[model samples]
Target: GDDAKAAQRVVRQWLAKKGITAPHLVMENGSGLSRAERVSAREMAGMLQAAWRSPYSAEFISSMPIAGTDGTMRKRLKTTAMRGEAHIKTGTLNTVRAIAGYSRDINGNTWAVVAILNDKAPFGASSVLDQVLLDLYRQPKLPETASVL
Candidate 1:
């Protein structure tokens, strides 16, 4: 947590030095575990838009999940239509289970998706979230941000 805090401060300073005006950006924790934290859906969308505008978009996209290989998405999406096709980050807490990622449709349209599930116990957490992702991949496009979780 300290590392993330320090990094956030340092980044904000660097961005300021570069003449970029940004928000306070209260990332309670880089991993989003703090209970009092608030993240606007609009800001998340803007981040995705910014990523698209970055010069290294190709590198960013390619570095994403390869389905069965690395990162939090490694165990999942083994042999499905999403194999080596999506990169998502999963978060879990007492009352939280969330995932956000990018998926490119067959038509080559890339969509960024975020899904969150809360106010529930861990009784069947893993299976429940797995089903969420399966449904999303099964559907046409990664539905809107609030569609599948």
Candidate 2:
């Protein structure tokens, strides 16, 4: 569909506005239907992090799949500490797997998470991503230093 092309142009414009020159950015289909679509984990992470700080952050976060509650993440990460702690959007294809969103660490730190894998077997990829969320939740909390605000 031409929506992909339009979306790609808009993304490029946004990147320019942010003064980010991502030479490797490639978007062939907005729905990720085409294998030609390409993106790096780093770029996706940057996008998610920016969304976290944007004025529409709440809207963006609310659109994601809440872990163990609803959407694609509903059935995943259930019965774990990561349940309801992660708002992730997952993507899968015959040869591609991707998950990107935000999660809170044990110390209440919001982390932007993104993982992209091009593998023949993507069945177990979600578990790997969920484990990361669980690990973040179980990580030891560092002593809080005095804030000089």
Candidate 3:
């Protein structure tokens, strides 16, 4: 109980400092794996974007699972063009599945992506999330055009 209280306090302070005002955010014990913990996909994406802009961005991104390379993503997107283009973090629960991370597109632009599924049957959610990343990686390259006067 005490640990949970302490965690809540610390998390609340961090959220306030970060100005994250997600109305539905709940950090139960700050473990991020609790059924009571809640955050919207928009909020998760915002956080990832913030991490990308932070001074420690390199270290933060390095800690994530690279698609088709390591961590939970070692076997994911292995045969697809998305492989090695995304650095993602995945979450799983009986009724919840989520992914949040950055993906570098074919045009060299980086994008933050997040997907969360809360359903009675979340079995196929990962496929949808993987598709999101794949689509990002497969974006068509921008056409080169002459500069206007």
Candidate 4:
């Protein structure tokens, strides 16, 4: 569609400015709503990691849904220890269900998590993604990169 193509152009220009050279990043509208778009879990994770390292990390993280508090995660993970511990963004499409966020672990370290499911019957992806975040919260510590800043 024209909109997707236009978004792709904008993303390309932004990526060029940022010196991000992802040769394999393809068919994306930067909105994750296009059927033609494709981003691997690893790529999404890398994006989250980069966001965490950026100077705007606090701003970006705060913009996401707060678990059991507001936005898309308002009711999710509500009954778990993960409640109020994560700031995440969710994506949904007929064939794609994804989540990306920073989850604060027990040790007060924030971990970036990105999970996506591409399946004909992706019925339980949200629950699975929530579990992933919860597991991160239960971890003894965030990944080593969390200490970089």
Best by lDDT: 3
TM-score per candidate: 0.63, 0.84, 0.85, 0.80
lDDT of 1: 0.62
Q: Return the clash pairs for model 1, or none.
A: 66-84
lDDT of 4 by residue, 15-108 (tens): 6666566566787546557786777776666677777778998899999999988999999999888889889899998877888877788778
lDDT of 3 at 115: 85
Clashes of 2: 0
Candidate 3's residue-wise lDDT over 51-128, tens digit each? 776899999999999999999999999999888988999999899888888888887778888888889999888898
Model 2: per-residue Cα lDDT over 42-81, one tens digit each: 7777777667778999999999999999999989988877
Prediction 1 TM-score vs. true = 0.63
Global lDDT of each model? 0.62, 0.78, 0.81, 0.79
lDDT score for residue 123 of model 1: 64
Residue 102 in model 1: shift from native, Å?
A: 0.7
Question: RMSD, each candidate, Å?
Answer: 5.4, 4.5, 5.6, 3.1
- Candidate 2 colliding pairs: none
> 109, model 3: CA deviation in Å?
1.0
Clashes of each: 1, 0, 0, 0
Model 2 lDDT, residue 73, Cα: 93
